[model samples]
Target chain A: MILDPDLPLIDRILAGEQNVFAELINRHKQYAYTIAVKILQNRPEAEEAAQDAFIKAYQNLAGFNRQARFSTWLYRIVFNTSISYKRKNNKVFQSIENTVIVYNHEGEVSLEKTDKTRYLNQAMMKLNEADRTALTLFYLDEFSLDEIADITGMQANTVKVRIHRARQRLADELKILLNHEALTL
Target chain B: MNRLSQAQEDILLEYLDGTLAAPAKIKLEEELRVNALLRLRLDELRAVHTIFQHASLAEPSRDFTARVMQKLDTAPSPTPSRWPIRNAIFLLIGVLTAIGAAALLIASGVFDGSTSISLNDSSLPQKIIQQEIPVFTFSGKLIINIIIMLNIVVGWILLDRAILRPYFQRRMQA
Candidate 1:
């Protein structure tokens, strides 16, 4: 059987050792935030949503059945929280400006890298939230299709289609952007 | 050299992901050798895939864990507690007991028109109380009816609190 590191921490929290939950939060915060950011596309809102999701996970610690991995459960919570936050706030697509790849002023390599990153970000923002999130999670290489499906509340086949479609759209957008850059150059 | 079909694109994606079987990979490679447009499309898809491959997890603010812990200190526990329902039930019982006592009083004729005391027959002087106390001629039945109505309202609210609200909330969660 596969061993889960978070299982022990979860048990401690369930047994009333509340402080250990901090370690659990720290361990999973990056991924949880990643999921939130993928869905919300806004850093501050994504942060809030991720924190709320952690608090929710903590509160519902006792109800967490160990059948699923802790990360999966936490991500699902993050996904739902971010989606609800998006709906409740009625936020327009906010740029994930902070998470963009930083460009070094080295030479032509850096310039092309920067352009590709910018094009990818713009293209990502153009797709609907589900497609963007699915593509992000799939390419993050941190989750399987099934885990992504669980986090997204979609069937695995649906997620596959979404990722496929999203990638195609991103390629099309990047082609236009790069072609424009080539023309300008 | 025309635009690739959806199936061809999917196959190229699977090839890029290293999931295409050997025969399909061989077939795709042969097509790519002959078709410049198809190869260009693959190059475009590869670039997009590379961008995603470089996508890193976004970290939260430096004090995110601290903020979450602070919030947790104030947030209520997540276990579905029955205490509110229990408290409502206790309150309903108290209200019912009060209504029952009022009903008993009605049954015992305590509020009957003939049962009031007179101030003129008191130990105090007439100068202190110039007028005799009027008999309480208000109908006992009316008082009972008002009490019953109030009790019904209270009972409905308590039932909603103790039962219906929790039930519906659970249903919504489910």
Candidate 2:
């Protein structure tokens, strides 16, 4: 049975049950890791950021206002922690302008499945950080635009615009790759 | 045909994702049927959306969970000590109580009177006057008077050192 982390885990953690903290970690680790990876884009750093986020969550558990959902609060921590990790490492997020459109060198017009997937991944990596985050939350996590806005601390309309722009950019990049391969062929 | 506005494009994307409401979905479908450019844009967006949906989920390192658990194990356990605000309040009340008690005692003449008494046995009237009202001196008095004054001052100093100073220090710390 899938455990309902929102119910007993929060109450137990607040009641000084330290072991329950581990349960909280186990339950939200994937969600936290996904957010961290989306922002930081590196597995090790994402792991570190996720761990730090959990520690901060544990430390500030007493101050958590129950008005917001626990998952919302936790996502806020994960997002902030990932941003801080990026800042500390001095790694500039891959911006849309800086994206390199890699194409297959051989003059092959037909697209292989792997090449299309690679092209798509590369295009995703080129998107603006906000767009990338919005798309990841919306498509991969199956979050609604409202939920994406909540996690991203942006308006729903803003998230909608971002996702639209990101999709357009991806399509444009794919078209460019496809044309470049066609020319070579 | 008017080009699809950014909002309309967003609606189309949402419709493709099956997130649009029924009325909005119908409206967008009607528009898509008439607008060739909007149809092309919708197809492109659908292609990108499909790719995004199928993108590989990046798995964390092999030791990801173990590392996270280890970090939690090593993290400083929240000590859950008494809140500084509560401690400060308790110390403030204690200091205020000590000050109030001291003020009450000083105002009530508990420590204001002298310790030594002078007696005049030479004349009956003087003796009666001395008996009726004693002329007291806290300084240059009898041994017992000096001892009593010393004891009062010593007691006050001890109380200030043992209680008042510590209370104030604790309040400041808080």
Instruction: For residue B146, give model 2's deviation from the true position in Å.
Output: 58
Among these predictions, the greatest TM-score belongs to 1
Error of 1 at A47 (Å): 1.0
lDDT of each: 0.80, 0.69
Global Cα lDDT for candidate 1: 0.80
Q: Tell me the docking grade of candidate 1.
A: acceptable
**Docking outcome class, model 2:** incorrect
Give the alpha carbon lDDT tens digit for every residue of B32-97 in model 1.
Answer: 999898899899999998878888889889999999999988976655345766899999988888
lDDT of 2 at A30: 77
First chain TM-score, candidate 2: 0.80
TM-score of candidate 2 on Cα atoms, chains taken together: 0.63
Question: What residue pairs clash in candidate 1, if any at all?
Answer: none
True contacts kept of each: 0.72, 0.31
The per-candidate TM-score of the B chain, in the order shown, comes to: 0.45, 0.42
Chain A TM-scores of all predicted models: 0.84, 0.80
Model 2 lDDT tens row, A85-107: 87777535444223322333332
**Candidate 1 lDDT, A1-185, residue by residue in tens:** 22567876776676677788889989999988987887777789899999999999988886675556788889889888988998887634332232342222123354554568867886786787667777878888878998888888899999987888888888998888777668757
